[model samples]
Target: MLNGLTDAGSYLQGVSTLQNRTVILSLNGNYMAAGDSYYDGLAALGICYEDYQKGGAWIFENGVPTLYLSGKEYSQKYPIKDGEIYVKSELHNEDCEDTELILNGKNYSFVENGLNILIYDQDTKQVIDHAGTDIYVSFEMIREEKGE
Candidate 1:
């Protein structure tokens, strides 16, 4: 009887395949996959990758990715490249204000002077200013004028 019990235990342990071990490990937060059942639970709490593309912006609550533009979910995962421009909007006085911007994984700055707003390029450090008047300047335009 003792030998039979030992054999049963060994068999059960042998039946624990790598996939089963992985599933168990994932359940314990030791592993993670994109579409795993356990990952879905984490995603519900915003604990997934909130990646964006060259011209994309998103917000990550926990780890999930939420697009900043449309509030629609992304069907695929992406990474934000260097010098990527991301347009976002802000609401002031119950009115929506849209702005074109980019972040180089460094600093964040906003320039607003009277009716003019400026967006700075992280790479060239150039400024693009937009005035309520029909006058607007791209960062490249400013750099070209300055011979930078």
Candidate 2:
């Protein structure tokens, strides 16, 4: 009886995680969001896109789709559910071979090699929560915004 209850609890938890709309940022290539490095509009912000040494992977999952920076030694394990997934995100990085975001499934992630964000209007409620329905996934390929 206790075991059955525990299993049911797990099932419910999984459902909540799947249905919840959110963003998951999992970065693998060199990330340079901080002020230590500077960039200009004409020039590209240099990061680990080409020189990813291929030993480590970055994974971030709070309440959204899962992502993976797969390699020969390492691979990400996905869930079995729809929002949560199970199978193979299996791919090599730009360092080893060409990288593709998805082989199968909806592009709900809207993920890119650089950064992904959420955009929404402030009229409905001011600051929008991650789970709110008014948000849109915005992927910034390069840090070329005006005024730095």
Identify the leading candidate in terms of TM-score: 2
Tens-digit lDDT track of model 2 for 66-144: 4444332344444422333222223355443222222124222232232322211222322111110111222213222
lDDT of 1 by residue, 7-125 (tens): 21232222221121101001111112222322233333333344211112233321233333332111222233244433443334322233333343422213221011123333344
Q: State the weakest 10-residue window (summed lDDT) of model 1.
A: 20-29
Off by over 4 Å in 1: 1-78, 94-100, 105-148
Clashes of 1: 6
Quote the lDDT for 50 in model 2. 34
Query: Which segments of model 2 are wrong by more than 4 Å?
Result: 1-19, 33-73, 83-113, 116-148
Residue 24 error, candidate 1, Å: 44
CA lDDT, candidate 1, residue 98: 33
